[model samples]
Target: MSELKTKPTLMEPKTFIDGLSDEKKRNDADALLTIMSDITQQKPTMWGDSLIGFGQYKYQYASGRKGEWFRVGFSPRKQNITLYIMNGFSQYQHLLERLGKHKTGKSCLYINKLSDIDVDVLKQMIALSFQARFDSEI
Candidate 1:
């Protein structure tokens, strides 16, 4: 089987966040690190050079492809911040309605900035996604 390209690295999550060239992105990434950490109660890890991941889940497909992935994660990107909400957004319509300006693609939640959204709702979404992924894995 082919290997997954992105895996955890030894770099500290905060250190990676701090190295971001954009001051605003750095601050937002830091806030996100805290939010995800609080929700998952797990230390963050670098998945590849960009994705800041928390917790983990293992999966094995019917074809016998087995792998592990982050329960939840995010990356500060040039266009916007991209959050990996493993459980997808359809089940969180209520939170999305109150999430301010954002976009979604399957399990991804994209926001232009933290100031554009209701943080409390985002926290709920992250917490729910983390728990849901955990439950689904079992």
Candidate 2:
């Protein structure tokens, strides 16, 4: 089996966020780190240099490919802030409608800035996604 490319790293998350050249993106990344940490009650960790991950889970696909992944996370990309919902977003259309300006790709939700979305709704979405990780364990 091939290895997972985006495994967690010992790299400090705040240092990574602080190194971003874009000040706005840096601030947003910090905000996301706080939000995710608060929701998962877990400290953020650097995943593959860019991703700031919260809690973790072990997943084994039907094909027998098994790996560990963050329960919920986000990356401050050049174009937008990409949030990993982990469990995909199809079941959250109702919440998405109220999410304001954003785009989705599979389990990722992209937003240009936090001001572009309702933070409370985003928190709810993250909470639900975070809860789903534990739910699947049971």
RMSD of every prediction: 1.5, 1.6
Task: Kindly report which residue stretches of model 2 are placed more than 4 angstroms away from their true locations once superposed.
Answer: 134-138
lDDT of each prediction vs. the true structure?
A: 0.90, 0.91
Question: Which pairs of residues collide in candidate 1?
Answer: none
**In terms of TM-score, how similar is model 2 to the real structure?**
0.95
How large an RMSD does model 1 have?
A: 1.5
lDDT of 2 by residue, 17-85 (tens): 989999999999989988888889998888997998888898777777878888899999999999999
Pairs of colliding residues, candidate 2: none
Which candidate comes out best when scored by lDDT? Answer: 2
Task: Point out where model 1 deviates above 4 Å.
Answer: 134-138
Residue 113 in candidate 1, Cα distance off native in Å = 0.4
> How well is each residue in 1-138 modelled by candidate 1, as lDDT tens digits?
898999999988888888999999999999999999888999899999999998889887776777888989999998899999987888999999999999999989999999999999999999988888443353
